[model samples]
Target: MLTIFLSALALAVQTTPVPPQTTQLPPAIPPVSTPAKPVVEADLRPYVALVTDLGTITVRIETRRAPITATNFLRYVDAKRMDGFQFYRSTKSWGPANQLVQAGNRGDARKNFPPIAHEPTTTTGLTNCKGALSMARLNPGDATSDFFLLLSDIKGFDADAPGGDGAGFAVFGEIVAGADVAEAIFNAPISPTAGEGVMVGQMLEPKVTIKTARRVPAPAEVPQGCVVKAG
Candidate 1:
């Protein structure tokens, strides 16, 4: 009877459930540092050149940034439409210091093309800085063959400002060289006859012209530099 009781107790103890052992894993090792992503630099060298007959003017076109405006300018250039076009306006509003020169005559029945949508500075990431080149427009989606070059920094004309109608002018290019030529173009004589037909309220001189324009190959890499001003 004692042996039977002892055997029964042992069997009961063996059948009881035992608590599972908790596991403590080893600390995880951190990964090593990796290289950072490379910065995407825009190539602006192919845009460097002289507009010729206007002095040694170096131009910088922003095709990657301002595709529409740049493409418009290039279209005219490729078609030889701007070869003999005139710089019809030179506003005294800027004076010599505020040198603002304009060219193009898409409004003319003889030289007109279909209007294009407004590509403001905000769209192109270009500003109306001194020597900046911007598309000319009346209302949104009305840009044609006209463009303007800033003689002085015109902050008021920026996109989303009072002048831009919340959509500032499109800036596709800049004068990288021959600022003196730009100055000369700025200082060219003017007639008082309200300039070109398109430039109402603003005066026009019809003094300068786009003797020629061409599309050189784009650069493989962007050149680190700033516009070289005249002495």
Candidate 2:
């Protein structure tokens, strides 16, 4: 009787049905990404317009990088001391064609201000490259009103440049527009007997006159191909 009861209980327990269990899971999250920053460019360089007999040549002055030289050039512009200036020299035969054209107060002491301290390329990080606007000096710190515009890269004018004086010319600015005008000035007539020493054959016969020079607003955008890099 006990064996039969135990067998009956086991058969009843094995035959009985059991319910299944289900678990709840949380939803998966989507990935998030960060946005990229926009690029911003600003040209805080100062601009100056030179109205000459040939045409207007716009120059961008590196005031921040070459404060002393830039400020000295601006002093003459602000005082109208450069009104009657002339581009009287062209060194097209120096090393390469279309080398440079120089202009100033023609060494008139009355029109020139006191000389400023020398600003080397080591200090300003500028160079005597194409379209460069640099001061003319017999020696460092003697540049007064004379300035020149280059039409080709002349590394010899840079401080520590190979085969050059460690203290080179100070390049304070560059031509931003009317490079054609500068070229015309460079190709102007040269007096065979006007200048002295090495400048004898480099003097402009009739000299291109500068009508006015004044500050102007920066261009909406830097002209294409108007890139300048520090030396």
> Which one is best on TM-score?
2
Question: What ranges in model 2 sit over 4 Å off?
Answer: 1-41, 224-231
lDDT by residue for model 1 (79-130), tens = 7777666666677654555558777753445565677767777666667888
Whole-model lDDT for model 2 versus the true structure? 0.87
Candidates' C-alpha lDDT: 0.68, 0.87
Name the runs in model 1 displaced over 4 angstroms. Answer: 1-53, 96-98, 106-111, 162-164, 196-206, 217-231
The worst-scoring run of ten residues by lDDT in candidate 1 lies at 222-231
TM-score of each: 0.67, 0.81
Q: After superposition, how far is residue 182 of candidate 2 from its true place, in Å?
A: 0.3
